[model samples]
Target: MATTTNSTVVANTSAPTQYPFLGLPYDIFHELCLYLAPKELLVLYRTNKTLYNLLKSADGKTGVDGKHLWKRVWQNSPDSAFPPCPPWMTEPQFVALCYDDYCQRCLRPNLLGAGQIWTARVRYCPECIKTQFTPRNPLEDFPKGPYLNEFINEPHLCVPITPLRVALGDRELVRDHFHTPDVARLCRAIIDASAGAGGATDLNEKRSSVMQQWRSQMTQCHEHAKLCHIWQKQRARRIRKQRLLAKRYRRENILSRVNALGYKQDVSCLGHRYQALQGPILAVFDKIDALTDDVIAPQVIAFFDERRTLREWYWHRLIIGVRLGYLTKALDEYRQAAPDELLPHPVDIATDPMLRPLFTLPMSANVPYPIFQGLLPEWIQTWRKRRDDLLLSMLTDDAPSLWSCMDSKSHKSHSSRSVTRSSASHPEGPAAIFQHFYCTSCENLISSAAATTHTCCYTFVENWRAEAWHAPKTDGKFPTTTSDILDSACAREFQGITGWSSSCLRPCAAVISDILITLGLNTKFNWSDVGKIEGMHLRCASCCADKTLLVMGWRRAVVHAFQEHQGVHLCWVSVPPAVSYKAQLVEHARHKLTKEETAKRTSWKCHHCRLPRAMDAYTKSRMDIHMRFTHCIFHPQQGRDYYAAPEGVQFLHPTILIAATELRSENLDAVFPEGEMFRNEKRVGFLSRVYVTNMS
Candidate 1:
């Protein structure tokens, strides 16, 4: 065991010593040391005893002998304009004060550099600065005597004063502050020196001499501090310029590589010009390294591809919005021309299978209005037929007896006609009686046209900007290449209809039929027939518990049944009073005007009521009685409570009307023609697919 221990010790001693770059000749080492900055040299000096001895002078401190090395390093530095060391301080001291980034008191390192009180020749952290400094206000701290006079006259000689910048409102104010400990030490020194004096004259002379020497040192310090402040500002500006150049260099290199990969157009489409692509570019904008192709190529490809995918998605939505806008305007004109016709909402038309493809055309396609105008008539016919079929199916499943009666009446009407029509054009059934449907989600009574467009079932794209569509992860990492963001946004903004179909609608028809039976009216009554019946108001029995006497039309009664009574059963009863005249009057006054009547009319006014001061005109569709509940004038007298003045009314100009009509009828060739319809070479590949999948 003793032999083995000796052998182990010898093996440990035999291990070779490693000296890295330090083994270089003194001349080479000195040249390398000159290349390092003052901060780097300071770091090297503290690394080991060998380097400290090599760089230090014979006096065992970095003194005059080593001053030349520091001077060469300073000359080679990026900011060579740094002021030379003053005669009172050594080169090492000046370099450490200017470049060392640690608090002198606490010794804590700050990479951003500790705050310097150049007048005091010290660096301090924020905590040390607050605790060590005292505001130099003579009236607050000193007696009203010679000491106060000395402070007011020669503050620098009495104590080292540093200016503290303070922000006051819009301006910056500088107040003199001093180190409390330094002030106390200086006062103690002055007092101790004066104690040995024989008389007042000698003591005054001694004090004057000490004050003069201190004042000279402080004056030099103030002048050097000013130079240092200017050097710091210039250095900061240069560093900022270098960083900005590095950022531009990296951005240009990445964009060039992306352009080579055939994404120049995509980048332009989603770049800062439109403010579309920000995340990936901003992620690398502040980077300082010269990014290599291998390191940045994959990230650039992933970022641009993902951004391109998002841009395509946005373009799809944009095209859909534009098409929907046109369709809405066209539908409004159609309704104005033919008020009796029942057309589906523009949104529903956009979602139709045959029409949806037209809306999903590539972004480059410039489809004219005439094409949609030509197809609108047939689309409307198909929509009405489908709506009738859906209602018929609903009645068959829920109210077979009502369906049978309507079918028989329809067959009889068909036989009465001399020409036999196809089943697609069969006579309309009693399904029109159930034109109004109830939304279970929102509990609102809506017409057939509005049922499919209800917010409860459909999602609207509110944010049109592409940049807002998706955001980077909070931790600053972006997804590599994935559709999770796009899918989530599409799920919110382009959802398929969830509960707008006939099967999903609340059983409003059954409730209306029950109400009809209660009122002793035929269940086969159409909307117009029901509207023609005078004094047809029904009161909610459930609401009567509050003694409110809530009477409403059949539509509102259906809504109340669902909202207040859960729509399982109705608690409605007909009013027994013979007040048909009064009921008719109330219905007329409360009835909302048609779109055709309210389009541009500006002379509507209520005779019974006027605006405050009677200065403003009232052009709202309903009478003024509708706006005030306390008025209780639902049965407003026509021409007395409400009248339409002929003079103030306006209509579309004849020339504008003729132009619009001609534009609609004008037969321009299809923009893309027959075979080229969906083959725009510049169109994004995934756009049509994404649109169809999300919108359909």
Candidate 2:
């Protein structure tokens, strides 16, 4: 059985194969080719070498049979007006020149409509056109030889010229230009044809014949090119109209289906604008596929659902922002009215038990200011007591002696104390001292009232959480969990903001005790009382050098001791009030003023530094030491190097004037004087100006 199967396979493989189409008679094939369009005929011709050889004419010229067949095909074409092939060219070559979508020089495919230069009988891309064509002037470019006169008499007949309309001022001027390779070929033909000629008469005859034939060919090509251009434009318009009709049909079908699905209002809400919906509904405008319920229904539902969700999220945020704004205003008013009362930090207040739910509520829910304002008093009392207890505990742990003294004094009877007795002579509890609390995070002394709103510990973490909550995730989706659960998870991630931490409270009490001992004052002495003592001005001996004078209040003195001289003792010394006052004035001079203050004071001028155009005006806050660094004038005297100008003098420095104007306009890019500490102040200023311009 295996031997019989092998024999059968061998016999089948050895048999000759047959194609039904190729087997047709030549007369039937030629008849069928007549019905095919020019483009389709070209496609059939390229199917294989057999078809290519069969379709081409003998002698590679326009044979009578082949020309008849091509002429019949063109006559029956949709564009029957297509011009006939010129006598010098074969029908196939002309067809390929008009129908092929490729550059003739580089052979790159897909040249489309703009690529073919029908008059030139060539298809070239923009890049190839640049290299192959040249703008010419017959008078300048004609060669200096015996044939120059003939060339000058009629240059258009010698070589084909493409007329280009160039805009010059108010009119259009037509210029003659020719293909570079074609011009070279024509000149070489003239030279070679004359080289072998017996006399000038014969050469002239040959040249005349060639030129006359080209002139006729150019005329025919120009007419043919015009027809091709019109046909291409008409075809483009027809295709565009068809596409538009298809798009409209698809869009209407999709909308009707969506409405049948009970989404009429949703579709109407999306509106007719292209970018209104910004969802799958936009696909209807461009998509060409047939509308089906299975394909478009789910897309319509999902798009509207997502849009509704985004709208709700936006409304919720707006409500939260507005309510928070109201709460902020109320808090500011309360703080100004009673500056001494301790209140919770703004961030802490935002996340309070009573107000947190407001952030997570639906858009329809009302969150009036009274809702937030009503809870402020309770929050203040609770937070104040909590902070007081924590500070007291820290004091008791760090300094038992000081705590006992303050405790005893508080418990003592007030009736027994005389009215004339000074309160500074007796010790008081930690609560009595104003601005005595310290923050280890900022390494600064703060008041008990200020401590309530001190944000050193929670500022960074709270800012991060706010940004994370407001922004979407990497994949552009909001959190899927419940708002309350998400809020709690975020809070837990940052360990929660529950007032001041132990690190701040404990270090605060210890630093205060250490500062009291260094100042030779009782640990229980109130900071307010210590500030009033005569000649109590203190400077850090460790930070102040020979010429450098550093003077500050007792609060800063305590901070300086804790931060700079943490483990070491005896870091500060008392200075005379007069010297301290001078040092304070100098220190104030070194500091930069706010833009508001700079705009208010304009009498300042710099005498030592001369700017161009007399633009020498400066603000009083700025001119005090502008000469010291700006112009390298050392030891600038108040009256010589810089001083307040007379009432009539106006500061006109461009930078200063612009800064003042922007400040008045509430623009934040007001330029200020460059500090001596930064080396690249000019670069910094340029970057700031660029940033402000971009933002605006």
Candidate 3:
């Protein structure tokens, strides 16, 4: 009987020992735990009491190495993308708050974005803040109204009918929800302690100091919450703006394609007919059209229209209901489907049971599908590849012309180097008129003569001019200088230039008057009194949008304009500015060539041939030889007719001719004069030599 009992006991002990994981050495077990993610660890903790106890800290507060583990997990997660935990918050507290979305007070889900109040370390919904948070009277609460104001301003303090702990000199008193005898004891303790310290005089100062510190802490909490709210609002606004811009671009692209396709037969054609599709349905059409290579075929459009997908009410809700990602994925599925099989149409895809966010009436199974689904995707891919190749070819083929422009021996390039030394030596003479001008950003002085030749630093004045020429005469006679513009009597006679839009033509008189007080110009010259004076036409260093009409007279006027008069003092244009239209064209060409060259260096390909061939040799000389033999055969065609011949031959992109024309015009000297030696210039002298006789 004793031997049978011993065998049964041994079997039971052996059964418990079957778990190998639990029997692992302590070091090995810890190493294994380290590999598991926070979520996996949480799962393991819930699975068994052994794992829970192993993870628990000796202090009985947090899991072992909880801070480091939770922090590492959060850092690697997408949730840590923005709004990082404030430095004042602990890792555990932040993780807890992030996961705890429900209101603690009511235990119901917070419908609004109810946030946590970190100061008191609690969460509350908006409803609970007003209903559950019982406001304590200030006079009765903290011996005065200090605690009341703190509580009122604190956005986080939502707990109502809660116990309060107050410091009363050396004694600590806890006041209950019902305001029991503890409150009275707190008041007596404070009074007694204050009297013992040094009488009422010292007591008032000590109380005031403690109240001040508490107020400061509460103020910090309020500011933190306010800043966070503002950041969230701004982020949301930026996302909304980007989406709107993308939608507008898509709509404009569709309209452009519709016009290009020549579908408009007459007044009642596609162009006029599409005008009826306004509002949300118009947006859907835009998105659909943008996805395809061109305007969808008339047959495909008819197929969609028959099913009421083109109808206003149906498409409107579908567009608003479906996400962009789901629509793209559905389109991809259609593209990959068998050519013989009839794939579900885009409208049907949108309303799929699994994909649908909102319940809707089922689309008819007999709905006509687009015949071109399999063919259209392949065509679209081909068209895109051809378009990109053409763009790249245009950049590559025009490399020599672009380089020639940069290497030109024009007077603009030589003028700066030639005149720099002369200007410095004769600072007070005629040569001094070309004195060096320094950039505020780069701090490099570009001589007036060199300004035309200089490569744009992008930080200096965007539109650099050789010299500030006199403002052009509008009606054959008008005062030309800043001094003339600001004159009280002369200002009245100044009307804007004719034939130009008001946006382009500045009312110079009004602008100067507004800026004159802030100018702090020369102590010697009475600029307002000077008549029929000549001033240089200079550009602003930071001005963008040519519509602003930024023509200024010396450095001082430019400085004043930058400081005052709706001045953001920023050059925000995407394209860098140049000295002249010619310079800008040259720079644009150079930039395009550089971009293409960089791409070619990575993967050399011969795009000139009928079948685009990647060169095996990958030599510049080989590329040149291939281009001369192959691409030179094609004749240049005007406009975008070049885009039509996708495979047969290459046509030059229109931008090439546009750039050449600008450079040619500058060379002719008829467009922009090479020097300031015009009939007006023979009379106009240096700034120091200004006189009435010189104006004639």
Candidate 4:
């Protein structure tokens, strides 16, 4: 039977082809089909006169062949991020072939640098030749802009690029006017006159000279901007290399340091090395010496003028640079311009009357200028001495104090901290009072570990270690205040807390420390606050009875209100004076009433529930203190050191986490895991692979 559909002949194979040309085993036909591209297969369909006659009669409804005509589209279309032809590019084959050549020849080697972060081995197809790509960018989308910022990076966040400031062309300095020597000389003259009281000449002549200098200088500045363009590109190239090398070498050096710190990055280990790179990213600009003697001097001169217009750009940017920040010889270098000759139109206007009236440098500079006009000299001398002391201290051969040294300790020694629960003197307290207490012996070890901390210790070993900080004193005009000593002590306390939290796997150190120093403490003590929290009117550790500070209730306002001000007044908020047009007249009329005048009454509410409550000011405050003492549910013991949601807080139950264990098992099976279900359900994970299950 002959069957035709539209313009195509349907091949209805009998047992095997009986005719001479069509005689082939079914397996052989399959093999031949495999060797043909889709287009070639279509061509094969038209080869025979019998087949063509059967297929060529109609082109109407047999659009399957028309679909087949798009054989090239099917063969060439890819679901890959990169393809033979990129849609961004009109020519696909050329781009694909070139990309393959680029990947094999150029980009792979370029990515090679410290720790293979710059380089990774690539799998390539020699025939097709293609580059590997990342999916961090969106494909087939409109350009990201406008309101798209919410979907992009944060405002001040930096990203890695070759740095455009380093890559611009010489023609970029359109506003620069200081390109020629003549223009520079004119700028210099204008800088000098504007810097001082204008050469004792007529004001109008000086003003004309100043404006002429500005225009000429602007031209040179614009021309010089082009010079910066070329140098900027070179500088940008330098910056790229510096960034790459610094990242590479720093990692190498850090790994070296970690190794010296007794760390070897095990291929099997996950975290510590990841954390090493998180330190202040060793600056990503060009090398420090790349600027050489010219870094501040010439760029400063070019950017600023005596009129402070161009110059203020440099000053303001320098301050922003300070905020972004680099180390400075002087701290005030950011906010104020220095008076060195490097600064535009260098002025020694100390003795001058007119100029001194308007401009003054910030106090960070200890240079007591007569332009400031009123300095006692001793205060300036004291500041200079302190600056010298700070510089000398930086250069001092100081081994890190004991707390700093403790940072590199073995993980086990730090992890086994004991939580000591003590009986409360008051019965009204939580069922348990817990403190992360150290053995006296362990504390003794900490004291002997560092001189700075030992100086504050009064123990036997510390009595000897205390000698390291003492110096023979001569009679002086003043004695250091105890307040200053307390301030220093407070900084060390925070430093200790910082060291303990991160390395000890305590992430929520701030909040935990707040509880320890405030409501849960044995005594009212901060290195700064020597006073007591256990007041009669205050909600404190000493007052709460069976309060049972649980992490669950701590988030509730009813519970947390107890920690604020005892039970008296829940909070005391300052109110601004009332604005009423008739308040003055009302006050006068009230005064006219004399002895029977009444005091103004104000309404108050409960801080915890926002419910209306009534009390006099004194009684209100007392009630607030009592409430905090009785109900503050936050505990010192709830440190964040685990992965699971803090036991009782059920705020978020995301779908991803719902029945996670079952999903995990399904995922393992999808990966073709070879295992049987254990009788003990807890023994289900890869982490628990070898553990025997106790089936009852």
Taken over the whole model, the C-alpha lDDT of each candidate is 0.54, 0.52, 0.35, 0.27
Q: Candidates 2 and 4: which is better by TM-score?
A: 2
* Residue 521, model 2: Cα distance from true site in angstroms: 2.1
Per-residue lDDT of model 4, residues 491-610, tens digit only: 222221110111111111122223332232432234343223212011122222241111111112112332333212121111112211122222233343322321111112223321
lDDT of 2 by residue, 541-622 (tens): 5565453335554555555555656623434454455544443443344344423444655456665532110124566546
Clash list (residue pairs), candidate 3: 416-449, 416-450, 468-536, 468-537
Residue 573 miss distance in model 4 (angstroms): 41
TM-score of each: 0.60, 0.51, 0.24, 0.15
How does model 4 fare in lDDT?
A: 0.27
Task: Kindly give the number of clashing pairs for every candidate.
Answer: 1, 2, 4, 54
User: Which ten-residue region of model 1 has the weakest summed lDDT?
Assistant: 652-661
Q: Rank the candidates by lDDT, best first.
A: 1, 2, 3, 4
lDDT of 3 by residue, 581-635 (tens): 3223333444565456543441233433211121122334444555556667333
The residue pairs in collision within model 1 are: 607-641
What alpha-carbon RMSD in Å does predicted model 1 have with respect to the real structure?
20.4
Q: Give the distance in Å from residue 433's predicted Cα in candidate 4 to where it truly belongs.
A: 44
Worst 10 residues of 4 by lDDT: 650-659
Measured on C-alpha atoms, candidate 2 has an lDDT of: 0.52
Q: For residues 193-311, what per-residue lDDT tens digits would candidate 1 score against the true structure? A: 67773876677666666666666878888888898888888888898899889977876777777788887767566434334445655676447888755455466577778767756
RMSD of each: 20.4, 17.3, 31.8, 41.7
